[model samples]
Target: CKCPLGFEGINCTDNIDDCSNHTCQFGVCIDKINGYTCKCHSGFIGKFCEITSQLKSSLLQNNRTEILSKTCTPEICSNNGICYEDSLNRVQCRCSPGFIGDRCLMLKSVHANRNDSYMKLSKPKIFPHLNITMIFSTIQNNGILIYFGHMGHIVAELFMGRIRVSHDIGNSPGSVVFSYHTVNDGKIHELQLISIGQNFSLIVDRSYTRFINNRGIRTYMNTSEMDG
Candidate 1:
């Protein structure tokens, strides 16, 4: 009795069904000329192979019953972020810019720049002031609008460098709105100043800005903050 392509016992009579025996949950058992090979499934490895391919995969899935049965260990993701196992049984880190550690507990570089210069804001300094210059161009028929929100007071200035006339919102803070009109093509410049005592501001530069104000409408007011 000879074993099948990937099974091995005494007389090859034993069917080394990787799936049935839970031997290769993450891999396929490939039958070789002499003996059967346990092609461990993704996230699993070893000969007869019971080792896990991913390190952190077991850690993140600690509460699951399936993981407890396996010989693999936890602590997969190196960074502090969540550990995600790929289709190849490999582990990956969904890490943030400045931090780079196995469990994401280590800091790689405190001031690492990830993207364009226009999007970086560091420390808390108001005197020097941060300048952001953006170039926007659109066709005549295209409707473009800019929208922004802030927790504190701030002044925003809009300029239409092109021949087309651009709408402008005043120095008022909280929420600012602006639209582009006239001429087929144009250029606009926007300057935003973060006022004193203000903590954070969210600015969105886009072609269409939608404003939903329920000033005239009346709705029930709760004694406490609304939690949905």
Candidate 2:
């Protein structure tokens, strides 16, 4: 009977213990069905002999799986989040709302909307790599609101009539940017509202503003204006 990959002995009964000698001298002695085969340790190869090869491929792969399995998964950040390994081998947490911390052991601030007048302008952007979602909401009066719970960084914009507001929360300009042009003439109040970040824009007449951008622009004109 042949033992598995790591074990070795007579009739595959003995384990080729590598630790006894502090390390395998030449190569690992893998016990087989009736005997054992010497898998030369790193840097050495050949049959019942000693030959060094610069291309030591087999030795490099040894114990790689076991070492990887021993790495501990990190548990950081708050709110029922998960731990993941970054490129630097550092563990980071993907936290939930109302929770935040280095090890996910602390509570974070909570902001909930109770007003029924407000509505979410657009759906959240999904990032599969970071396992996060970013959502943007808007109200008739409050402008745009960003929610980044598990997501890393988010960029959004909001527009109202001739005013445009945009922001990149994770980048330099953390606050909103405002741009607009005023139209004093009340006869044909043509205001163009452009929100580049949100991919939306709008044009408003005397009664209401028309929205445009990614969601498409619509003009909100009065009944009289529509009739004309």
Candidate 3:
């Protein structure tokens, strides 16, 4: 059957969606006759929006010009952001919550008062490798900050002015409370959490860095299978 530039079906009546398989790596995809085009976000370029804007200032420590040979990679996405290739095979970043930017290096602040609101994902997620960073403040001395996982879960909370983390890799869940600085001073504090395999470490910046250079906390169940 004879079909137009962007028409399909046995009788050439169905309009073909060229954009279905052509997604912009950093911006929007617009469909055209038998093809698609990309509208890259600020600081990106390429036929499929795969290049980073940093290329414009390619300079060495001595201010020598550098050259480009490839597009962005998994390392390009910072702040626990994940890099991916889009439908058109261009580079893109999957940022964590409270983050934005082409490389996910910027923080998007969220202000919450007493019982303001909470967010629940409509789907479950997996985290073979994870890093989460945030800044928060509270007048209360105890509460949960973040909770994630399914069969194996992890929870970070404020335990009596200290940072506590509860985790379960595959077995029973266990917890560890940071014994350093206090954080419930009604002022903002920075929190960074990282997990490699079954090991985990954290840093709570409240006039001090806690738990980062120290030991990691492992999660396990007690004789009564209770959260510690």
Clashes per candidate (backbone, < 3 Å) = 25, 22, 1
Residues 14-122, model 1: lDDT tens digits: 6554433233333565644544566655554556444444434545656434432212234544334556665766555565433453445333332212222122233
- Tens-digit lDDT string for candidate 3 (165-223): 87665555344547477789987677877665566667777354433221234332122
Which candidate leads in TM-score? 3
Report the Cα RMSD per candidate.
21.0, 25.9, 13.9
Model 2 lDDT tens row, 48-158: 214444213423554434323223454223346677767888666666543354444343332232333233444433221111223222233333334332212233233
Provide the global lDDT of candidate 2 against the true structure.
0.38
Stretches of candidate 3 above 4 Å error?
1-107, 113-116, 121-127, 206-228
User: In model 1, which runs have C-alpha deviations exceeding 4 angstroms?
Assistant: 1-72, 78-80, 95-98, 101-105, 108-228
lDDT of model 2, residue 148: 33
Rank order (by TM-score, best first): 3, 2, 1
- Residue 68, candidate 2: C-alpha displacement in angstroms: 19
lDDT of 1: 0.36
Q: How many backbone clashes does candidate 2 have?
A: 22
Please, what is the TM-score per model? 0.20, 0.23, 0.42
N/CA/C clash count, model 1: 25
The TM-score measured for candidate 2 stands at 0.23
lDDT of candidates 1 onward, in order:
0.36, 0.38, 0.62
